[model samples]
Target: MRQRLIGGIGRLLAGLRSPPHAVLAHAVFPADEPLSTLPCVALDTETTGLNVLRDRIVSIGALRLSGGSRDNTPPLDYLVHPGIRIPARSSAIHGISDTDVAYAPSFALVAPSLLGYWQRRVLVGHNIAFDLAILRHEAERIRLPFHPPAAALDIGLLYAGLKPRVATITLEAIAADFGVTVDGRHTALGDAETAARIWSHLLPALSRLGVATLGTARSLMAKQRDLLHGQAGAGWAIGDLLPPHRGPQHEGAPHG
Candidate 1:
C-alpha cells in the first residue's frame, strides 16, 4: 500500500514538472461534434508480454475510418524488433517468434510514421489502454514526443455500457454478441480489423443512448473505468482481462 501510494505521488509530481508542450500535446476535442463525422482510427498491438512497464511492442496494426465509412487507404502494419528476445510464453499467445522479428526495424525506426498516422485522429481499440500505454512507453524510450489522443474510445467499455449485466467482455464475447466474425484472432491486424467492425456496430447503440460525440463517449468511458476501479481496487490491471492464449480455432496459428 505504501509503495503504491508513493508511486502514485511520484507520477503526479513528474506530470506536474513536465514541460507545457508536453502537457498540452494531448489536445482536448470539442464536445458537441457528432462522433459520426469525426476521423477515427482503430489500432491494435502485439507485444512481448502484458506488462506495459516491462513488455515491448513487437507489432502494430491500424486502419482509418472517416464519417462512418472505411477508408480505402492502406492500413498501417509493422513488425517491430524489440531489443530483447521475445519470450516463449508470450510467443505462445501472439505467435510472434523472436526469429520472426529478428530482422524487423526497431520501434525507433518506425516511431515517426506511427505518430504521423495517429496525428489529429481519435484512437479506438478493444481495451485500448494497453496499446496506448505500450506506445507511450516506446515513445519515451526513443525520446520521441507522444501525446495521447484527445478522444479515445474503448469497445469493451462501450459494450459494458450497452449491456451492464454481461459478466464477460472479451473480444470474442463481444464479437459473438454482435454476430461479428473475428478472423486473425491473435494477430495484431486481425484483432484491429475485428475491433473496427465492432466499432461500426457500437456507434449506433451509443447514439441511441445519446452519446453521439467524442466527448460523451469519453465521459461514459471514464465513468465505467471509475466503477470498475472501485469494484476491483485501484491496483487492477486492464491487461489481466486479455486471454493469454488463442481460442481453439486459432490454436497453433501464427500470431503477429
Candidate 2:
C-alpha cells in the first residue's frame, strides 16, 4: 500500500497528466484569533472508491483541534461493514480485506458517537471535500440529513496558498515541506494525523502572514475546492445541525 501511494504519486510527477490547478477563492476574512481559538475536528475517511455517490465508506478518523491552536486531541477512528463486499483492488490499497470488517459495527451502531464528537463545530482536514462527501453520504444513508459545517477549512488549500513557489502541492509534498511524518499512509488515523500536521504548519504561517482569520481561511478553502470542478462557492455550505431529535436521550427510552 505504501508503494502504491508513492508510485501513484510518482506517475503524476513523471507527467502522467496535468496536475489539477488549486485556485483559492476570494472572500471576506476577519482576523485569526476567533477561528484559531475555536474547537474543530480534523477528519479523514477511507472509502470503497473515489466516487462517494457510489462508493461506500469503509472507515473514518477524526482528531479534534482544541484551544484555538494546532494541538489535536486523541484521534477517533472506526472500521465499519459498509453492507457491501469490499473490492479486492480497493482493499489492496487500504490493506483492509473484507474479513477485516466482517464483524465490525454498522454505521448506525456508532453514529451517535460520531455525532457526539463532531456535533456543531468547525472542521479541518487536508482535502476536506473528500471527507465531507463521505460524511454527507454516511449521514444520508441512515436518513440523517447532514448540512455541512457552519465553518470549515482545509489545510491543503492553506498549504498551497502559503507556498506560492511550489509548482506542485500534493499531501506528500506539503508533509515533506513542513517536516511532518505520515506513519500510516493509507490508514484513516494516519491520514488524519497527516492533515493535522499540515494544519500545524500552515495555520501558524498564515497567522504570521497577517492571515490569521478563520472566516478568511474557510472561505479560501471553499473557493479552492470549487476551482477543482470549475465552479464557485463550492466549499462554503453551512450545515447548522438540526435540533435534537424529538425522542429520548437513550435508545429504547421514551420521548421527551
Candidate 3:
C-alpha cells in the first residue's frame, strides 16, 4: 500500500514537470533588438485622497532597479507632506493623518531632492499612472519644469501582457498567484520595494514570453491602453500624466 502511495505521488510530480521538448525555450530577459539598457526606479506615492486635481501626495517612495546585467544603486526613499489636510478616509489607507504632515514640508520644498534622484531614470510602479499623476501634479504646481522621466512603466500592466487572459489583475492578486510576499501593505516605500521585487521575479516569465526589454514592455503598455480605454484626449493617461483618482471623473488619467 505504501509503495502504491509513493508511486501515485511520483506520477503526480511527473505530471507537473515541464515538457521535455519545450524546456529551456526562454532564457533570461533576452536583450531586445533596440533599447539596450537603462536605469529604472520602482516608485510609489501616497496621497491624502484620490483626486488628481484635488488630492495631495503625503509621501513618496522609490527603490532603485537592479539586475545581474546592470550595476545600479541600492534602494532609496522620500516622504513629502502635501500642503493640505488629510481626509479621514485617506489617512486610514496610508496611516498619514493631517497631523502627521502638518510639520512635514510641502511638495515644493521636497521636489528638488526627489527630482535629483529620478532624473534620466525610467519610472516604475504597480498601477504607476497614479504615482505619476501625483508626482506630475505636485511638480507642475511648484512650477517645476515637469518632463516625463526617461520612461514610465506599470508592472500591473506588464503582468497583464504576460497573462492577458487573466480575469482580474491587482497587486495583491498577482503577489498571491506568483508566490510573492505582500510586504509593507500600503506604505508608499513598502509598496515600491514590493514592486521592484515583483518586477525582478516576473522578468523570467516575461522574457520567455518575449517581453525581453524595456521598449517591449512600454510598447505593450501603450497598446494595452488603447485596447482598454479605446480613445485618447485624456490627460494623465500616460506616466504621471495625472493624479490617482478615488472619485468619479474627478479626472480620468491614462495608464502609465
- The model with the greatest lDDT is 1
For every model shown, what is its TM-score relative to the native structure? Answer: 0.78, 0.72, 0.74
Per-residue CA lDDT of model 3 for 1-256, tens digit only, reads: 2342344334334423535323222222322533224466778888876666777887777766554122455344445567767888887888777666655556765555555555666677787766677678777788886555656677777788788888566778887777879887788878887787777777787778777776576666655654335212233435332223412232333433
Q: In candidate 1, which residue pairs clash?
A: none
Model 3 misplaced stretches (Cα beyond 4 Å):
1-37, 68-74, 226-235, 239-256
Error of 2 at 146 (Å): 2.2
Give the 10-residue window scoring lowest on summed lDDT in candidate 2: 247-256
The global C-alpha lDDT for each of the candidates, from Candidate 1 onward, is 0.71, 0.60, 0.62
Measured on C-alpha atoms, candidate 3 has an lDDT of 0.62
On lDDT, the stronger of 2 and 3 is: 3
Report the candidate with higher TM-score, 1 versus 3. Answer: 1
Instruction: State, as a TM-score between 0 and 1, how close model 1 is to the true structure.
Output: 0.78
How do the candidates rank by TM-score, highest first? 1, 3, 2
